[model samples]
Target: MAEPSNSGGSIVSGVAGRYASALFELAQETGAIDAVAADLSTFEALLAESEDLRRLVGSPVFSAEEQMSAITAILAAAKIGGVAANFIKLVASKRRLFLLPAMIRGYRALVAQAKGIVSARVSVAEAPSEALLAEIRTAIAQAAGAEIDLEVKVDPALIGGLVVRVGSRMIDASLRTKLNSIRLAMKEVR
Candidate 1:
């Protein structure tokens, strides 16, 4: 697997953090981080596509044995072998499948950080065009002075404009927020 860029940092802590850290460390030691990350991305896409699979992982109704068997079969059929395959099986066997999503997120975060890529979330009134997204990426990378991974979410209620958040800093450029500010100013004027 190709290694990501030069993002320097250690993993996080807490339940999800601990699990992510362990998995990341193992993948790193085995030089399989990229492979594991790809597998996890595939798994995440599967979870998003299949409601029954989502329920199976997130709901407490299923027995651990059932989840393990089902997930094992799914992994095998998906041809998702390697550190990722084993790590997921372990999580299911431990009845921690409910935490899988968070673990995946945590893993992605670590991978991003390792790649020296800052993550930015942008919420827009509609799906952005590729040109717009590329523009945003260039702007953010320039501002951050680092490689960036952008996640765009669509919220029609925003009316117009987009909100950009990077780490603890946020730019509330959404029309909804601007309208709210105008309303607040009007109240003050009254």
Candidate 2:
């Protein structure tokens, strides 16, 4: 995943938050919240996967009009329309594409909040199996007393085990942490 432009999942604050709030209200009013959210997710993934596209959005090299036109063409090709298409065009025209990812995240937070589901980030040493994911989801659901909307990732540096962060609470069971503990113990040995 691309490095986040701001603090953590959809905590939406400052300029990004305001833009997100406005977009959320518009999407909500038009009943296009789901469509917009999906489009934004696709756009975010596109940004992550395409370095050129990311640069176009975030670079000040392109004029507002150039960015706007390119984004419109891209959105059309992607079949993204409705409030999402219009809102994003407006953002690009205003030169706010740099914050698009954050706004998208904020919008997601709004949608998830409306649905009463909590989003959690979990990273494991490698891709988790279906059964393992299901078990983790079940555990998180039970602990949060709400539906689990999990975002799972793999970090090979962890070596083994998993790390979970549900809001401010973090459970680290990664092999890296265990190794660090062992290293500290050896250093203290006389």
Name the candidate that leads on TM-score: 1
lDDT of 2 by residue, 57-127 (tens): 88999999999889988998888888888988989988998988888888888778777878899999999
lDDT of each: 0.89, 0.86
RMSD score of candidate 2 (Å): 5.3
Error of 1 at 149 (Å): 1.3
- Residue 81 CA displacement from its true place in model 2, Å: 0.2
Candidate 1 lDDT by residue in tens digits, 1-190: 3332233434455687779878887998999989999999999999999999999999999999999999999999889998999999999989999999999988898788777888899999999999999999999899989998888999999999999998889998999999999999999999
Off by over 4 Å in 2: 1-11, 182-189
Q: Go through the candidates in order and give the clash count of each.
A: 2, 0
